[model samples]
Structure formats: C-alpha cells, structure tokens
Target: MPYSRTDLKLEIQTHFDKGFSRDLKILDVGPGAGMYGGLLSEYSDILDYSLGFELDCLEIYPPYIEKFKLKEIYKNVFIGDICTFNISSYDYIILGDVLEHLSIDNAKKVLNTINKNNQKCMVAVPYLSEQGEHEGNIYEAHLQPDLTPEIMKQRYPSLKLLYGNDSYGYYVNYNFNKMKETLVIEYNNLFKKPIKPIYPKNEFKVNFIKGCKFEVIGENKNNYHVEFINQKTNKVIYETDITNNMWTKPSLEYFVDFKIRITDQNNVVWENKFNAENKRVYIHFASNAIGDTLAWFPYAEEFRKKHKCKLIVSTFWNDWFKDTYPNITFVEPGEEQHDLYAMYEVGWHYNEDEDIDYNRIPSNFRKMPLSKTAADQLGLEYREIKPKLSFKKNKSQISGDYVVIAPHASSHAKYWNYKGGWQTVVDYLNDKGYKVVMITKEPMYDDWHDSKLGGTLKGVINKTGNFPLDERANDIMNAKALIGIGSGLSWLSWALGTPVVMISGFSEPYSEFEDCERIYAPKGKCGGCFNKVRLDAGDWEWCPEHKDTDRHFECTTSIKPQVVIDAINRQLEKTP
Candidate 1:
C-alpha cells in the first residue's frame, strides 16, 4: 500500500469536482480492511453507490462494519473470490495489491477471465524491489513466478496502463497514524486494442529507362526475401534476401512474376508483386501553366539517351528551346502533329482516334488519350516521352528590407482564416519595427479589409492579385522570407529554395518535396488531415469539427504568432 484513506478521499473528491458522476456504481475487489469502504461513506452525497468483496471476513470486524453502516450505502458485501463474482453489474472494479500473490500462469488465466467479462478493471501491484522482506504469511506475499506490468501488457493487448505512483514511507506513516493503507494502480484493463504502427502505402509511380538501375522506394528497413515465381511453372525461379534499401538491376527475363516478401526478425511483414511489361516512356505536354511543363522536362533528357530514340516535346512556350539536345527535339502543338512518333496532350484534353496505337503511350495517362480534335486545334503532335534527370537548383537569393507574407491559396477552403489569428502575427511583426507585405489574389482584397487588422504599419505593402506566375516565383525568390498556408505557392517557394514557414492545418507535411523551413500544424486528431481521404469523394477539406465548435480550432489556436516568428528568425540565423 502506498496511499492512505485521506489521499484516496481527496482524490475521489477531486474527481467529483472535475465533473465525475456522483452516481458511480464502484466495485471493490479484495477489500482488505474495509478502510476504502469507510472513506466512501464520508462523502455520501458524491458517492451514490458502492460494492465490496473480500475473501477473508475477519478483516472487517463487527465494530468497523457498524461504524460506517456499510450495508446502507452498498447493495451487498459478498464474501467470495472475485474470479467467480459477476462483474458486469458494476461500473468500475478495483483490484488493489491482489495480483502479486498469484503465479504468472494463474494470474494470466484470471486476467483473461476478467477481460472477457468486465468492460474496465483497475489493477494495483507493489513496485517490488529486487529483494524485499514481507513479515506476513509466506503465501500472502508475492509469488516468485508472478508477471510484471510489462509482461502482462503484452499478453493483454486491450489493457491501457494508466497512472501509477512510486512513493515510499507512506506505509509506515499509515500504521503510526492508524489511517487507511495506500496502494498504486499500475495497469487498467481497457476494452480497446492499442493502435498499430502505420505502414506506407505501395502506390509509388516510378518511371525508369530500360537497362538502368532504377531505385524502388517505399520499402521499410528489413530483410526482403526476394523471390520470382514463374506463373507458367507455378514454382519459384529466383530467391535472394535484399539486405539493403537499394536494389540493383536483375536480368530482363527475371522481371516477370517477381514476388517480394519482406520479413523482420520474427515474421514476414510485407509482400509485393511486380508485374513486368514492355517499358514505355511517359511524356507530359501542357501549357506554361505554372511549372507543370518543367516537371517533365528533366525526365525527357534521361529517357532519350537510354532508348536511343527521337524524344519530341511539344509545348506552348519556347523556354526550353535555348538548351540544345542532339537526341531530343521540340515541336509546337499545331506545327507538325502527323510526323511525331507518340503524342502527350496536357490538361483535360482527349482524343477520339480509335486506330491510334495505345501501347506506345505512358501507362498512367494511356487510359484517356488526347482527342484528335483538340490536338488539331493546338497544332501539336502527340508523343509519349518520359523525362529522366535528377533536378537540383541553387538556393533562392534573398535581398529585401521587408519580409513577405503571401497567404493566398487557389481555393477558399485551402486558405487560413487570417481573421482568426493571422492578424495578430502581422501586428506583432509590425510593432517590432519589421516591415510586412501581404500579397494575395485580387478578389480576396475586395471581400476583406486590412483596416480591421489594427491599422497599416510602416512599410506595410498590400500587393493583391497583381503578380503573374513567373513574377510570383521571382517575388518569392527575392523575398527576405515567405510565410503562408500549405498550397501550390508554398511548394513553389520550396522549389525556389526560399526559406518558408508554412501553416499546415489538416494536411501532413509533404516530405518528398523540399521547401518547408518550419511547419506549424494543429495538434490532436484533426491536425494531420493532409494524408487522410474522406469517405465521400471530392477535393480534400479540413475537419468541419474545428470550424465552429466551442473548442474552435484550439489545435491551431494554441500555436502562438511568436512561435512562428521565432522559427523564422532561427532559420535566418542558422549557418547554411
């Protein structure tokens, strides 16, 4: 025992004060001396009901039982073991210092039975030293083969280990003061299973040229038992263990029916099947719509050398024309459509030519090819070409007196409510003698006024909906620092190698792309909404529960404006 009746009474009183129900039907198992029962009676108004069960009846004498009138507060005081008692009738079951007496095997059996019958049970065990003396009956002390808290948790996955205490000298003081004994509850048998570890999904789309060793990502660190089972023979053909994360090139024949089994120290954890087909290059053609055209340019350079075929890229703008490529050729959309080997139409345009060969196209976009009508209008030849080249760029050159706060996103749902707390951040920075620039789309300024944001400070510039895509990129590239909600602009800022402090509300930080200097997200269940997909299909949206509830985005609200400012200053001070 580690806590007295006074402490227990105070704890119960505190629990009630914090809105715990007074009509709690509590069940006490192995109530050693009925001191706990006596304490519950002191607060008759708060504790509406209680039940006590004891194996030994002599512990609670006639005088102690009469003093509290135990039978009046509770339904019954049964004289029997808890293992046979009906447990569902009560709300809570307290098992105080009773588990250490039983052997490991017997205790497991009792725990299993309790788990099967009860919804929740609180368990208390002594934090026994490596060696300790017990003056009681030899059988009353803990057995040598008793299960510890850690071992018990493994056996019972549904159990949730709650609060525990490790205080000494309380037991001696309890005897001297003639007070109730103390014991710590270390484990609670909850009716729910613990959450399992999250495994990354295997939807990675990789484009690799033939004869080159392309790295397959999204594999966990483990012994991957690689096996190629021939579909024709129904037998295994190749077998090897991939010890490292990187996999080298195998024979071209070995690509078919490739099965990978990843195993840990004890058991197989993941299995993947790779289907082989003729490797076709993917060439994406789009208008100069932001940097969508640039995404496919690097990959085209790599595919041309390996395939030894003419790589033709059709675009609206001639930004890539200056860079000479012996193997690669550039053709405008409508200039020469018939001479190209394959065609890649950007955006939502589709083709209706039924006789066109589909196998030559990229696998991801082949299902819906470009329409012949749209291709004729744009004057572009459709060619399927996959660009291959590692892309790296120099860091953004920051040269400016004021820090820019470009918080505009494409969608309203994607926008952070500046009315909520962003205004506080702008005001704080302004008051500290730092200039602030708020850049946004033109339509946003007409709907919202900056006057409410505590009068415009010195050097405060509001350039709304004016800069074009390239100009916006240049503005971010030259800014002292950029801060905004997670959006395409944030990704663009990252691509420019500019330091960014992004406010990620519901989405997970896109770790694959680099750009985020520091990310601020709402804490708790609603924080990481970026990775989650809703049951109903549409564009992703933030948690509606955070919108208008009493809690009111406390997850986001808790993150102060000063915190973001500190993170930005730290990044500026760091050695590059």
Candidate 2:
C-alpha cells in the first residue's frame, strides 16, 4: 500500500516552490506512504515559512493512519472516503493515485465537485496500469485501468497536463479557480451552460464569479471598483465598488458585447471584452410550452452562428430539433456543462414587474412576437427563422387527401369560441373533397364553461388521443393543410412546412408567426387581451376586460365560421 514513485512527488514539490505561497491550506487525499504530507510538514517547520502551511490528510483506511504515521506528518488526520469528503475549504488538493480507485462516475463527480468550488487541484494517475486489491485494503484496487492523458483531457476538459509519460501523468487544475474571477451568466431552459469571463489576473485581483457566487480575495476589498460596460456602444451597463470581501450579482444578463473594467487600489486598471468564439455557450428554454420552444429554437441557432461559439442547448422537446441540427449539442433538462463561456435562457417571462422581467427580457414580451422575444433577449436581428424538425418517416395513418385540425389549447381562452366553429369547418372540408382528421392529445373539457371545447365532430376522422409528438408531427407533415387554434399544434403545423389556418381571437396577429393564415376579430371587437392582460391560468373561461358583460368572450364568438373557412380556402389556394 506504499507509493514507490518519488519523481511525481518531486515534480509537485518543484511546482509548489515555483509559485505557491507557503501560507495555504492543503488536503492530501489517499496518501499511501504520506510522502507528500511529510514533504509539506518539513517545509512548515523549516526557517521563515515554518508557521504557514496547514496540512490535512484524508485517509480512507483507518489502519493507514497508524501504519504511515500520518498523524505526525499532517496537522489533522481525518479518516473517511475521499469521494464524499467536502474539499471546499482547502486552497490546494492532491489526488495522488486516488481517482483510479473510484468508479468512472464517482471519479468525474469528484473532479467536478473540486472544480465547481474553485479549488486548485492536482491529480496523478498511473497510465493504463492494472492492480488488484493490495494487502487487506480493498480500496487499493484500481477500478479505472485505462486512464491516459488523452482520456483524462476528454473526460475532464478543465484539467491541464503538468507532466505526463507512458508510466503516469500529473494533471493540475489551476484554471479551476479562473471561473471564480470571471462572470458566469446561466440561463436554464432545459440545460444550463456557464459563460466563461476572461480576466487579466495580474492587474485587477478578483477571484470567483461563477453563477451567482462571487468572491474577492485581497488585502483591502474597499479599494476595488468594478464597472460593466456595453462594448458595442460604450455605454456603462453596471458599476459597483467592492465594499466587502464577497460580492455576488444576479445570474441573468443581456446577450451583449460585455466589457468589464476593474480599478484596484494602486489605480491599475484591467479591462476585457466578452468573447465566446470557440468557447461553449449555453441557451436554455425555461418554458416547456411547445409553441414557445419552437418559436425560440431558431434564434438559438442564430446565436451560435453569430457568436461563432460551440453552442449547447436544452429544450423540453430536444428530439424535434436534435437531428435536423447536428451541429448543435442538445442535452436533456438539468444536465451539467463544464467550461462554458456564457449562458442564456429563452422563454416567456410572465412577471409583470419590469424590475424582475427586465433582467430576462429587454422589453415587454407581450408587445413583441413570440419568436422576436428570443431575438430581443439574445440581441439578434428580428427575423422569422423556422426550425427544421427531424422525425421518423412513416405512412400517415389517414391515407388520402386529408386536412388536420387541432382545436385544443391549454386554456379555453385560446380556443376558437365562434358558435359551431369547428363543426362547420369540418363540414366544409368534408364537402371540399378532403377528409378531416382531428389531431389533439385529448378531448378538451373546460370545467368553467361546462362544455367540451374540442372533440370528434360528426363526419370527421377522430385521431384525437394521447399520441407521440413525432408521430403527430408526421401526421401533420403528410396533411394537405392544418386548421388549429393559438396552440402548440398550430406552431408545429407551421414548422412542418404545412399551411396553417390558425383561428383564435384572444391574441393579436403579431403574437404568433406571421406566415400562418391568422383569423382574429378586428381590434375594436375586443381581441388581443391575452397579450395585454396577465393571463389568469386558474380561470378556465378567462375573458379579460369584457368578462361578465354582453361582449364577454365576443372576441372569438363574433368571428363567424365563414371567416375561418375563407382563411383555410385562401391558404390552400396559395400553397397549391
């Protein structure tokens, strides 16, 4: 159970002598022979640097504490598992042949934990070396035998190779603390990516700025003045003086050319601009709403192309966009990303307070188109960008000239409330030599209105049931045209390149995509309340402004069934 190699220990000592301050806290994990601990303790007792080092030893095997005299070498000898041990307080950590013993996931988690806490770490592993349990210590066996310099770099991108050979490799993560000095803005739609901020370390001294956690370590924190500037226009975005040792800012940020200037006590100024070129940037879709995700997805690609960043995106519906966009990395919700240059979130922010919502979006979301909100948040040019969907191609269940109608929405307010609206359109389509297929997750029943909103109409094929999204997309793809409300299916129909005849009066025409054939009551007829008023989700029959009046719900009720028929006819004519 003793380490035979002295070269690695000497190399580590050389690194320490070169730059590391003697006044530091160190943790030696799984020190087999206590060689590194002994060396650190010897330095602690010798001459002027004698009263500086605080060395701790974490040995998993309790017997090793006595066998190696770890008690004499370390100031505190803690007997515990290294994988679960809290390494946050230490300034430097040495994982000497410790990672090879842990499972691959546990090994990665250990490194991730250390890096996340901004701790400087040194890891050494025997390259492709295989060993079984040594002595009575079962923890001495190498669980990972194929670890190499290339494999380590691939698995842990933050690690920098200090020294390596065919026998062993010594990796250092000094850059782990680099994230702390840089601002990390995280947006979580489905997945989160931390944007890395570049800092000139020698000039302005600030440590730790990842996410919402911020810390500054220097003699006098009051002497530090930080200013955030918009690099594009030279306007000051934010400025603050560091009064305490720790300062944290809100994680949400506008996608802009961020320039940071820091003035230290000596009046030494440091400035750096936000650059994500070749760096990983994350954009998350916080809302799981299908329409919102589809509308915002195009801008995510645009952000990637514009910034020239390695883009990672998270959406509730990743399968819909993953295949079509092979260039972008799509992750599931809540997956962690390391070494991110910047992060952004794209979705509808419902908070009416400008103070709260302005951090997420620059302007009122209700005033902008659904897709334009993403464009505005990311500082991209406003334009309609349709996301291409990839799905399994199969014969649509309904074979022949058919028209798909999705009449259900989350709220009854988004439904087409015209009298006999859906049935009349179904009859009209049936008379127009087209089979009408109703594709909804389920029949919509509005309890407040005490009526079934969308169900199988007479003389129409009822395809309404809980079906897979890709399957529904395929059905929409094969259809000649789709008639739906201001719902996800209407957006899906448009994304599939199908002519969409959208019938809804609760929202403005600009609220949805412009290309869709939108049918709404004129402005004076009491429409567009969904965009103007804060939607009361609990109220099933929410008729804002005109509620309980003669004109209650007249926005859609006033829109006759003939208007929808004409829109559908016009769309079909234009498409064919």
Judged by lDDT, which candidate is best?
Answer: 2
Q: Give the TM-score of candidate 2.
A: 0.63
Which lDDT tens digits does candidate 1 get at residues 1-576? 211223233333232233224466667665544444544433332333331222112212233234333454345666445545666666556665555555666656666766666544555555442323233324345563334556546654555444344421111001112111221121122222332222222221222222113233432344545544445456765455655445643333111334444455647756545422233333445545433443334444544454454566666544433254555566666665433323334343223753322222222222322222222222234343322222333353333355667665543334444344566666666676556776655433453434333234234576657666665666665666677765556555655666777765544554213335655454453554333432122533344455456544444545566677776776555413
Best by TM-score: 2
Output the worst ten-in-a-row residue range by lDDT, candidate 2. Answer: 194-203
Q: Write the per-residue lDDT of candidate 2 for residues 1-576, one digit (tens) a residue.
A: 455354445445435643467778889999876767755556422122432355898999887776556777789989888788888889888988888899989988988898888888888888888889887789888899988888888987888887777788888888534432222221111132321111112223222122222245422325567776676789876777764455645444657666777777758466666777888888888989889988999999998898898999999989888878988999988999876767787766645563336766778888878999899888899999888888766897887889998877778778877767788888898898999987888653424332554343676787777888888999998898999999899998888799999987898889999988899886579888987877889998788788888888888888888888898899888655
Residue 314 in candidate 1, Cα distance off native in Å: 4.8
TM-score of each: 0.37, 0.63
Off by more than 4 A, model 2: 1-222, 243-245, 248-252, 265-268, 350-356, 444-450, 453-456
